[model samples]
Target: MEQTQSLVLVITTVETASDAGVLSRALVGLSLAACVQIDGPITSHYRWAGEVQQSSEFRLMIKSSLSAWPELRDQIAKLHPYDEPEIIMTFIDDSSEGYRNWVIDQTT
Candidate 1:
């Protein structure tokens, strides 16, 4: 049996909502992502440069196909502000049929 390709949700955080909007637009415009949802001014606590740090950040949930992953990663690397931006990918194991089809149609 052949393995099936599924959608992925790419998550990242930025300092401001404006950055989220900019990055989201670029991703969609370039066909790198089908949809991008921005959420938060949520609190983040993490270690950076060996120092513990805390900050408010906006999170971006980007929806795209697995095939687009590489270019999407590259694009985020180019556009993200943090020296080491939080770019994480999670495979979407299941979703509504309509929504899944929409994602596939939206992304190349």
Candidate 2:
């Protein structure tokens, strides 16, 4: 195995547990992401349609690489239920070497 490149942590929230599961499975099944951690029932307070809204949502921590970002984003956009899904990708500066390598290997 080669040295692992930088990875991305994409954070997103959805309205339902079922939506979370669907998104998670799609990402992993397509090898667009190595894994997706779903942490649920979190309250989300945000602005929508010029009004502050509060909702219960499931959060997904999607793990992928820069190389996979474009496709991953497209896939998420296509499948995400919301008109404007919150798929925010953050670069990981440091991570476990073994796990990072594993993520890269699994995805691409």
Candidate 3:
């Protein structure tokens, strides 16, 4: 069957493992995301509030369909602690056929 919606990988960073866990569960439980992989205590260096800041953060790699992007983004924005959080989406042009189908099945 031809796919109407493209798969995407959404990336975001959170302050702690607890926050990561919360986001991962919410997205998957709500069916906005098929899977969420959390990785880190990775170090981040960026400018915030007119100053350079450094911190340890956890990264959430969320898998979902482009069709679900809006709701997923909105939900993350609401639950995220940062006034402006990092929510970036990348289109998945290729993947294992079975895995791709699984993502479609889980999200829809």
Candidate 4:
């Protein structure tokens, strides 16, 4: 049997909502992602430059096919403005069949 249900949710953050929009558009336009949802003016606190820092940010939740992970990741790096942007990926192994199929179709 062939495997037909593999997807990934890639999460990343940027300093501005405009940055989020730019990244989202690029990913989808390149067919590297099926969907990119931006959420926030959220606050994030983390250590950077050897000091604790807090900033307002927007979060990007990218839906992509498993096979597109490498390219999508590299694209994010190329477009991101931060010195060390946050790029976290999670496997989406279970979802409604219609949704899963739609994502795979769009990305592929």
Give one digit per residue, the lDDT tens place, for model 1 in 10-107: 99999999999999999999998999999999999998889999999999999998888889999999999888899999989888878877887787
Which residue pairs in candidate 2 collide?
none
lDDT of 1 at 31: 90
lDDT of each: 0.89, 0.90, 0.91, 0.90
Model 3 Cα lDDT, one tens digit per residue, 15-106: 99999999899999999999999999999999999999999999999999878888999999998988999999998998888888888888
lDDT rank order? 3, 2, 4, 1
lDDT of 1 at 15: 98
Cα RMSD for candidates in order: 1.6, 2.2, 1.4, 1.4
Candidates ranked by TM-score, best first?
Answer: 3, 4, 2, 1
The TM-score, computed over Cα atoms with residue i paired to residue i, of candidate 2 is 0.93
- lDDT by residue (tens digit), candidate 4, 34-64: 9999999999999887999999999999999
lDDT of 2 by residue, 9-103 (tens): 99889999999999999999999999999998999998999999999999999999878888999999999999999989998888898989898
TM-scores for the candidates: 0.93, 0.93, 0.95, 0.94
- Relative to the unseen true structure, what is the C-alpha lDDT of residue 57 in candidate 1, on a scale of 0 to 100? 97
Question: Which candidate tops lDDT?
Answer: 3
Comparing 1 and 3 on lDDT, the stronger one: 3
Candidate 3 CA-lDDT value: 0.91
